[model samples]
Target chain A: MTNKLLYLSQADVKSVGLTMAEIIEATEKGFMEMGNNRVEMPPKPGIHPGEGGDNFIHAMPAFIPAMDAAGVKWVSGYPGNQQKGLPYINGLLILNDPETGLPLSVMDCSWITAMRTAAASAVSAKYLARPESSTIGILACGVQGHTNLEAMNVLFPLKKVMAYDPSPENAEKLARFGKETLGLEVTIVSDPKDAVTGCDIVVTSGPILKVPHATIQAGWLNEGTFVSCVDFDSFFSREALKEAAKWTTDNLDQYNHYKDKVGFFVDCPGVYAELGELVTGKKKGRENATEKNFAANLGLAMEDMAVAPLIYKKAAEKNIGTWLTL
Target chain B: MTNKLLYLSQADVKSVGLTMAEIIEATEKGFMEMGNNRVEMPPKPGIHPGEGGDNFIHAMPAFIPAMDAAGVKWVSGYPGNQQKGLPYINGLLILNDPETGLPLSVMDCSWITAMRTAAASAVSAKYLARPESSTIGILACGVQGHTNLEAMNVLFPLKKVMAYDPSPENAEKLARFGKETLGLEVTIVSDPKDAVTGCDIVVTSGPILKVPHATIQAGWLNEGTFVSCVDFDSFFSREALKEAAKWTTDNLDQYNHYKDKVGFFVDCPGVYAELGELVTGKKKGRENATEKNFAANLGLAMEDMAVAPLIYKKAAEKNIGTWLTL
Candidate 1:
């Protein structure tokens, strides 16, 4: 038997309305499950266009052994998604019958990618960011930028947020949304330094830089602040990153896989511990909150694995999404 | 931005009573495409049940370089698909937008697998079976057994067919289908030796014997007859299989993958030259019909790749199945 599929638009996920705080808890639990080998996640290696920015598809399926859930999420990336006015990443997550090898449901994975990516940053912040970290520097206020702000603000005490973007209109809109939706003190910064300076958290989420721009000078990074880069080039030095108390990653295999695919980011090599490894006690967590401590990225399949069941549950309860039977 | 998805049912594949034959030609071409690096296929690692049998999931996406066609097929096999009143394997083939990574179609692939597996048997017989072969020994008359008869009868000029099954009724039905539908002389045998004796072609399809039964004996295997096995255990003797003119398979890697997972048949060791390598001249097809030969049981992903486009084309031409827009 095939599983019933749910079709969700952007409105449906927002209707289910999982706040970022709940998201962080769920995701952290997912990491712990993965650390214990209680989750099924394998690197989704497909085709790449080499250095030419080729089209690629990824099927990231995970079964959270602790939670008793299985999900298969497939996503594709191409530069052309932008040209067609589409989000560059497109995908669907199929929740499945692990025993029967039958799919249970197919749901929209675009928002899952967006929400999970931000939630992973929050996962890092849960263990890495200062508890009272109130000031955050937001770089590149696009889809990722907006979600990052929401994810961070939901889990941490953020009294002030700053954003930097090349587009003045994007910065102004991000400022408006931050204040109106999130109720935080917002600043539209003229310079990246204005965004990065004196902040307890620094978030970098952007496209691959073409000319290798430097926004975080080695001297400019805030001492004892948590910095997370969804993009690899966000930080330049081991010293710049090691200032924090801990180094945490979503998954080591995934990061290493990307390292092989996308290459080393600014020569900062290795990690202190993957978040899963930390959760499993294979490595230690933050020794102190004030050292330039927690660092990580988002390649976690369980984050989506963790969230799909929630979406499936809420959608079924609400009679939401598309339905098909096999 | 969004790819239009076409859905194909099992009913959509029936056309001209020769869809299976067409499927074989497409698979032959597909293998050549794979060897030329024109297809996007990789080894599909799967679940190990830690029981008596292991299952697999194969994800094959192909872009026919000459035809400018692209599709991806995902198939999963659990040893128990039959016991559950379903096919032993199930999957779907998806056609996609090349530039956007948008899925364009979802098709029922159980029938496709049955067809393609039989098609490979047909292709093997075309090259390796004796030119004047008139009689065939059809073993284990179940789903695989029946469909394989269709492929064999269509590909070769045969005068008589024999059947052997534990269930005499199933064997009788197989014999009837061969004579009534395929228009051939048929005999139902009480013993496997009775069926295998004096046959010019041997097509063995069935489950591995749980407790060894003597369907095939090493001494009774005929020289100058094409011997093909559709199950892992049937390939017991490399020397016996090699008694024919050519040795081949559908895909060497997939066969090897299964070999690695299950280990080689205890009896056969010189299983060389897959069907594709033979078709592409990397290995020889048939030096002479009288030479002893064997084509080991191997399933290829390209056959799955080939039919996705065919189904897409057929579904569109006939306006069959459902359409979903993403």
Candidate 2:
């Protein structure tokens, strides 16, 4: 049998220039599919190698029947890579044809991870955030912080953003990127409280660590604000989580697994509904216009499966990648 | 960062011309590492899509600390592929640099699976089988059957093979392969009973089904015959498994997982030792020449990880595959 696979590098995928709107739409659909019970995503299997078991490589596999997408993403997070001047996170995604079980494309997943993660939070915001939300507060000015801002613009008419980073240089870099790339008014705040106070939407995209400290306090959030903690509650205070009218996660299985690993979800208020259930209308998203909602999105393989196939289709249509026979 | 990955096709891997003995040694070494608790192999995560869930795609990721090798094998088995003139089993293996978490090579896993699986059986025979074996009995004349014979010849001085298949044409094909490739005298038997009776080594390598039924029975073997059931318990009778003096599996977790799914391991005799323990000398292999030993190998990711890097090194030295920068 002759099977030729398309190889899309990070550069090639960048050249394809997938729009944030497209990714958000697809990611929302993926969450809807999950809520509707049309997807099969097992809890990722992980292997921790190297010293101290600090470095981890996880295998995330999923099948979305509605999208006819099946694939696995092999991703790694090495905290020590910073010392060696290498990327802290890198991965590869293999997309397979659901019918034939043949790999259609192998693409660098750094872009996919960044885009899908941001899109998940954006989708949660679309359902949970208040209408006519304008200002946004972002914690940790990194890839997730920047992409989260870009994704929020798809569904909200945001005019300004209050950004904060522990590193002042990174905060300035994110501010410049926001002004140049997204053309939004950006303010670099010195304190986490200044960054989060009185914002319509709040996003904590900081690095995940073992120790949990209250960063965003309960008193900082404004009324009717939507909070999305993409970093597994590392930045959100337990008091802040308890103060929310409704709290949810992307998937229950993954949330519990990580909760066991790091004590985050166990101490927080009970999850009222998963984001998928709200997206699919299986459960209520916001009970009232004044209700405060908090969503913890750990990300999902279904999101990657949904978005990778679209990128593959776009790359193939544009003839943007190297093709090799197997 | 110039992360270029090597790609080895099925043809490229076949051209590597890996010797059966080398693979057996590496696979045995891998088992020893597993027995020594030097490898991290999470249970495989699988996705079963479509109706009836007859087809399955599994992600097997493993890290061997001793080998300093890490990888994941994405494999699929579709029973319906035969109707569409496609191979039932197709897969790919991606080898990553354990230290840097960057992919080094992506190779076709069909060859690796066949060779490593056969090598595992050969390793079991080296420890479990009688040293003075002269004849072998093989159930099912497929890839496993032919490769098992080739691998067994590396450790045993077998004079002839008794082969069986439900179809006469396949029986003849296996007989020809045994004669032409292995230079062994082969007899195609009409019944499973005739094929397995009074042989020094018996291997039940047939297609696994949902229902468990008896195929190879207790009375159809010699007193000290080494029995290896590579296809779960589909071919071996419970009575035969009970008759053995000692029974073992490659991995206890996987065996129990399948036991929950198919009700095989629960009814069998208690496991004396895993193959790794035997290879590591942590446990005994055979107590005496008259003792009967049974092995059930459920195919581990460590086997693929152990063999794929050797093939990658060979391909790199020979400059035998396409390289793409990621």
Candidate 3:
């Protein structure tokens, strides 16, 4: 008769420190489960029945079918959030009983975003990125950029990391941050190509309302390299994506929705073969680590979907916040 | 920057002891605002294209375009809920500022539900039930049954109350309980006709798994008597509802969803009106004291919509729960 309501605060969540490494790892695990077809990844575009609002509020919920736990997360994006000092991406993740209706926990979703998006990139790298890849190129120094590197390092043994960001402070901040925190060799490059050259993994987390090119110089792309992105605009050419040996997304319906909103990124490697499909083995991962591939890391609901259960468990174990009794 | 999560026990809500009279008055205000088209009731059924369940989760949100707050109450009906002990209807009424996304409160929906459903019913009786209605016939003497009497008594001058239940002891217990607590005439009738005869109103708050019908001898329905139902059964003939001078519901879309689920129990009255629509001169209420009318109280999102605000205001004023630094 009791409702299991667990509350976790930013401080509580921080004290527990859902680490950058942890998010990357969980995301990889998420993809592993998804690829095995044990994770539920429903479509991501939501109700647009209302008028005049540019952002879409999507409902992403995932239950690792084998794990017996599920979480439903609501992610709302309105580009206008910046003018108001709110993070452009904002959401809540509620972990609940998969069997009963009790709400087990509620957590801030900023971290959920980092892990899922990066996990998606990691899945692409595991399957499509070159095995001998020694360097990685990054396009931004924000949160997604931070996690993307962690995911790459875990899934691939990269020797060098380089980035291009207009903000000196961001570049400097992440320069020291990545080295000290992630233990990666880092450098700040002056131009996109300065960072793009000779790299086997090209990762782009963009400030893309303003962007470089969607299509990179084909000559610049080393054979058997991989390109991963959170923004399709960062790599504008569908042709660039088409050239890769393989294409993938966290979920295909989501990729299609994104295509509808932002236009073609590439003929997506058929949407069903998305990360979850790959996990489920409906499709195979990299024929070899040397396969050239492109994965659009559009952040699957399955990421928050899978992570929701983790947050609920941790918060409950700690008796984190005030319980709501009804 | 802060989330005020509050919990109230069912006992605490009962302690609020807001009578059907007070709630009736509050709903009058709610109706005035709703009638002005201030209440935003949007189409709730959105099927997730790739979702695997037979049930759909709907979101019903409203902004009293002129009020201090807004909320999107997510009412997810998976139907799998019934196999578990959970109540079929479950959701959170999130209260937030209209100008800012600051959440003022989060409260249990059960209280909001019990009160608002009763309030809407009371408002219906105020406008549609017979004047000097001395007695009422109650079918399905459960939660809905108990509250309908509480609300009806507040809006009418009832001299007696009678009920028929499949479980005779349950009927006897409820009757004894009502007589002791409600303090007026109450009885457990042996026959459905006995419960209905000589009563000015017949109330049906049914949650029957299948359709239920009550065959009425002509005299069992006194002249100028009214029928109110929370059920979608073939309890009364189509001729009965067709002959009603007025036919109404709290929200039209909700009734339509119900209509789709349970085919018409009555003929479509040539006159169809919303309770709030009538308040705004979009339609009219009862025109004659003797008019036999039917009010189908399917309930609305806007009713529980006020709970978070009400709880926020009350909890803030009374310093009811502990606060957390998140």
Candidate 4:
């Protein structure tokens, strides 16, 4: 029978007050479950509506048998939306009961995407970064840059951040946020090398696609530095990636799916281990403090599935979303 | 900015009273647009959640550029749901503005699926069946049987109907509905052969997948009989498909995707044309009244896209459905 469905708006999701620590732990649990083979995640199917294929809407569906949760996220990204005064990416996620296949809640996915993606990087940092990591480098200072900093700050006790962006105004804005809101010393740099050089943690959160740009060289990374690439290998040089003592990804299947198109990791060093393997103790993370480790997390649906239930639970407890009859 | 989105329930959709003729015409127009290269349809991506893959949830997305309608339908079919007193299939569809990628409406897709599937068969029948068809035979009397009859009744002035089902009680129910609702002379037969022996149009609406059962032979079909198989070659013999003067499908890409898995359509005769080709006048349908033709309508998202806008409009005019802000 048709029933009333919970609908969480963007404001409601934000009002749920999900902390970075909570999201990171939730996402890590998803990775552990995935390693245990308790998650069913299909490769996302995408629709390219624009003629040039510059934009995409992808359907991400996953079922976590352990949690008895199933859901699908319909998310879209259009680079051109920025110029039109709209968000670059917008999405909606529907959570359903795995047993009956009945929808329980629908929520805005933009916040989830931002938080979960950042949490993925933070999880990698927690496992791979040095315990004394205090300085961070962030290229492409945007929403991801800020969120990633927030996620990493919780684990690393970061004190200083080096940021870079093509646009000076945007870079200055992020620097201001880091210094004022986050209470961390920040430096705005024009050259990308200034961001990654000599930093304890380096993150590349720039635009994705095949673009001819300056790459981070191996010489810029310190021996104990940890690197997280969420932008499809755009910033890291092939030399830097190959030189790391350990290289990993969020999921192997997704890594291989984009390996050819993103034009990286074709014949690089074998993957050290997936994030899940590390979380589940199937593989080691950092054996020594000086070991250079790198992680490439092509975000997975299992993480979204993990965090959506949290949001749904929180929203329900707080009674913070619209309820509509179906 | 978020806006109010239309939400149409099953009752609201039914209250719209969308005529069978309107749906058939809309479905045909979608085919014509697809043939003219004005629609963007990706292969439906599916997730098998049930253990052993007994149940599946599929995502179907389409953008009809000509009509400026874009949407995605999330549909699930769980055969085991019947034992739990739930319907075998349930779905929801979201229509969006193509220009901004903003969702405009969310509606129940159960009624849409039922109507569009029957309309697909009717479209094929209109283009391929004889114009003066009178007598109809239906196998596997179910919702499809009734819907297909409703669609075909608009195209033909039917006088007599012959129906058969594995369950005689179901067959008698359909017979009663035919005699009482449509005022046609209805006959309930025990044998599948008795239903199709001298019918003008024969429709096989049985269950899908590989099954061993009675197959309708070529001898059972008259010279001018037009056969439509909603089932995947279950009730009809491979020889019947091979002996037809012409055979076509709703979409070639989807047909080929399932051709090997379904274990039919391999080593079969070359497909004469797709339904779109006939709708666009790129290929002939029935060249003569005596020609025996066959069509397999696998159902398509373009048909759903066609009919959803109609439902949205009708709901808007009648002030029906709940409006939810997202």
Give the best candidate by DockQ.
Answer: 2
For residues A202-318, what per-residue lDDT tens digits would candidate 1 score against the true structure? 888767552345557766667668777876655344555534456667777777765566655445545778887766677766557557755657566678878877877787798
List the candidates ranked by DockQ, beginning with the highest. Answer: 2, 4, 1, 3
Off by over 4 Å in 1: A1-19, A48-53, A209-214, A234-239, A242-245, A260-262, B9-18, B47-63, B67-71, B80-86, B208-215, B233-239, B242-245
What is model 1's DockQ versus the real complex?
0.36
On the 0 to 100 scale, the lDDT of residue B157 in model 3 is: 85
Candidate 4 lDDT tens digits, B41-129: 88787666768777777778888877777888888888888888877887678887666566778787888999899998988998899
Model 3, span A130-195: residue lDDT tens: 676778888777877777887788777777888767787777876786789878888898777766
Instruction: For model 4 chain A, give the 10-residue run with minimal summed lDDT.
Output: A260-269
| True-vs-predicted CA distance for residue A196, candidate 3, Å | 3.4
- For candidate 2, lDDT tens digit of each residue in A1-326? 23888899889988898999999999989988999988999889978889988888899999998988899999988888888887888888988878877788889999999999999999999889987888999999899998998898778998899999989888988899889988889999988898788789988888885566678777888889998888777887777777889888899887887788656665877788998899989888877777888888888889999999889989989999988876
Candidate 4 contains a number of clashing pairs equal to: 0
lDDT of the candidates, in the order given: 0.69, 0.87, 0.64, 0.83
**lDDT (tens digit, per residue) of candidate 2 on B1-326:** 33889988889998988899999999998998999999999989988866788888899999998887898999988888889887788878888888878888888898899999999999999889998887898889888988898999889998889999887887788898889988899998888887777789988888875565688777777788898888877887778777788788899888877888756665788778888999999888887877778888999999999998899989989989989887
Give TM-scores for every candidate, taking all chains together and pairing residue i with residue i: 0.91, 0.97, 0.83, 0.93
Model 1 CAPRI rating? acceptable
Reproduced native contacts, each prediction:
0.14, 0.66, 0.09, 0.14
Question: Against the true two-chain complex, what DockQ does each candidate achieve?
Answer: 0.36, 0.76, 0.23, 0.42
